[model samples]
Structure formats: structure tokens, C-alpha cells
Target: MTKLLQWLLGVSLLGAVWALVAFDLLELSLPRTYREVAWPIPLYLLVSFGCYSLATVGYRVATFNDCNEAASELHEQIKEAKEDLRKKGLKM
Candidate 1:
């Protein structure tokens, strides 16, 4: 659900950018279009999807921890669980 919301927001942002470009609102010295705007929705979607996928992969890689780190975290959790059980007078 969060992913869906993020995707929607990204596509909306890209659409806004495309609109600004297509209508020459930014005026970045690009060639101006005088005809009615025919926004290529499909192409914009493709570009947005590509960008989102790249960003997601980049974020995962940036925050990823090594296997040893993960194993230690799991070990700590298990130790805590056993201590809690022992306090409850339960044998493990």
C-alpha cells in the first residue's frame, strides 16, 4: 500500500513536469510548441517506472547490511526471548 502511494505520487510529479515542459512554462530555451499538447502518457509512465525502480534499488543497496549483521540481530532477539521465558519460570 505504501509502495502504491509512492508510485502514484511519483507519476503525478512526472506528469506535472511534463506538462510544464510541454507548455513551455519553464522557458529553458527549448523549442516551443505552438500546437495543441498531445502528452504521451505511455512514454511518461515508462520513464517514471524506470526512475522509481532505479531509486528503490539504490536505496536498498545504500541501507543494506551484511549477513553477519543480520545474523547478530537475530541472535540478540532470540537471547532476549529466552531470557523472558526463563523469567516466566518456563524452561527452554
Candidate 2:
């Protein structure tokens, strides 16, 4: 699905940023070690998972707002139609 792809993309981007920062910190704070090479992948995965969760929440919020707006518009149209019918001596 398009939404799945979007979430994957967002997660990848956030994971990349997280990996960069984490690698930089490790490189600066620790001496040369196997962890420097080994840590990034797991770190990326963890960060990506977090990012994906946040993205899903954001997507749901956006979807809910759009649906709410559409419902409001439909209610307004129904009210207008009823008003017009009332003018023509029809009652609901």
C-alpha cells in the first residue's frame, strides 16, 4: 500500500539520521572497537521502528481530520437542502 511505503520511507530517513548521530557519538566517546561496526544496524532498526510508529500516529491523525472536515461539509449541505425543501412547503 502507498501508506506502508510512505511509512517505510519516513522510517528509513529517520533511521539514517539516528545512525549518523549514534555513530558520531560512539566514534567520539569510545576507543576503536568492534561495536563501532556492529552497532549501527541494530541502532538503525530500533530507530526506524520508533519512527514508523510515530509516522503511523501522524497518518491516522491526518486521516481523522480529513474525514471530520468532509462530514462537516456533508452536514452543511444536508441542512441547506432541508431549508430549500421547507421553503417549498415540505416538512421533515
lDDT of 2 by residue, 1-92 (tens): 69999999988987676565556644555444644664666667679999999999999988774578889999999999999999999977
lDDT (tens digit, per residue) of candidate 1 on 8-72: 99879887877777666777656544313435655766899999999999999999876998899
Off by over 4 Å in 2: 1-36, 65-92
Instruction: Please give the range of 10 consecutive residues that has the lowest summed lDDT in model 2.
Output: 26-35
Error of 2 at 62 (Å): 1.2
TM-score of each: 0.34, 0.31
Clashes of each: 0, 0
Best by lDDT: 1
lDDT of candidate 2?
Answer: 0.76
